[model samples]
Target: MDRNAKFIAALKRLQGVAPIQVWPATVKSIQGTNCTVDILNTDLIDVDEVNLRADDEATEGVLIVPRVGSLVYVGAVENAVDNLFVCQVSEVDRVEVKIGNSLVTIDKDQVKAVRDKCELTLSDKATLKQDQTTIELSSGKVKINNSATSLKSVLDDLTSLLQNFTVTCAAPGSPSAPFPATITQVTQLSTKINQLLS
Candidate 1:
C-alpha cells in the first residue's frame, strides 16, 4: 500500500475504546515519502502512536511536549473507506533548528520534519539522513549510497548545508559561523567502519 494509506491504517489501531473521531484532512503535501495527518480528534491524542504503528520495526517511548509536533500512521482495512489524507502543517511561521537556536522561516507544507536539526534530520519514515542538503527539499528521502569524504569536504558540506539558516554560530567569536556539530560526523564514522569491515 502507499505510504499515506499505510500510515493511516497504523493510526487506526491506536484509537482507543473511548469514542474517537478523525477530523477531515487533505493531502497538504509530501515530506519525502510519508504524509502528514492533521487528525482533529475530540481529545488531543499522542502523536507517537502513529509513528510506532506505521513502521513496526521501531519501538520508542513517546513524550508529547506543548508546541512540539508529532505523527500518526496506520495500515489499511478494506471496506473501511480508506483514503489518503496526507496533510502536514504547511505554515511553519517559526521553526527552531537546534537546541538553543531561534525560530526561522519555511513553507508550511515542509514543516512536518523540522525537529532538532543536528546534522541529521529524522523523518516520520524514521530514517536518519543529511539535513538541509539542498535548496529545495520537496520531500525528505533517504538516498541509499555511501560516499566517502575527508574532513575538509565534510566541513564544506555542513557550511553549505546550513548556509541559509539565520542562527548565528557564535563559538569562534564570529557571528556568521554556525554551531559546530552535525550528523555529518556520524556519517563519516559509519563510512570508516564500513570500509574496515569490508
Candidate 2:
C-alpha cells in the first residue's frame, strides 16, 4: 500500500457520495401548481415543467404563484434523472389566501377581500367626503331642524292670513242675542291661536 494509492482510493469514495444541486432559474410560464423555468448558467440539461413546492400552511393559508420573469430556485438530487422541483420563489409580488369560496389578497398598498359580505368597524372617528350625499332609510320619516329665520317667517305668514280672513255664524235660538254667540266663536279662535304660539 502506498500513500498516493491510499489518497486516490479516498478521493474515489468521496466522489461516490451524491450531492444536492441548486440553480437559479427564471419562471417562463405557470399552469396550476406546475411551472416552466429556464435554468441560468447551465447548458448540460434541459428541464420542462416542474411541480411547485407548496408551503406547509397551504391547506388553510395562501399559495403564492411565481410570476413569469421572476427568479426562483430549482433543486434536484445530484446524479438523479428527471427529478427537479421549483423549491421557492425568489421574488414575491403578492400573497393570496383562499377561505371557503372567498379570496383574500394582500399587497403593498392594501388588503382586500372578495366575499359575499364584509363589515368594518372604526374605533376612532371616520370621515366620508363626497360632492353630494344621499341616504335611504327604511322608514319614510325624516326630521329637519328649523332655523330661527324660517320659523319667524312661518309665524308671520299665519298671522297675516288670520287677520284678513273673516268667519260668520248664525245666532243660536235668539236673533236678538246674535252678537253674544259670535263673541263666543271669536274667543275660541283666540284660544287656538295661543296654542300655536306655545
Residue 104 accuracy (lDDT) in model 2: 70
lDDT values, one for every candidate? 0.37, 0.58
lDDT of 1 by residue, 1-198 (tens): 999999987777766432233343322233422344444443423222232122334233221211234333233233132433222333332333323332222233333343365332322333333442222222563233234533445455556656634455657877674334445554555565454234
Candidate 1 lDDT = 0.37
Candidate 1, 190: how far from true, in Å?
34
Give all TM-scores, in the order shown: 0.17, 0.39
Highest TM-score among the candidates is held by which one?
2
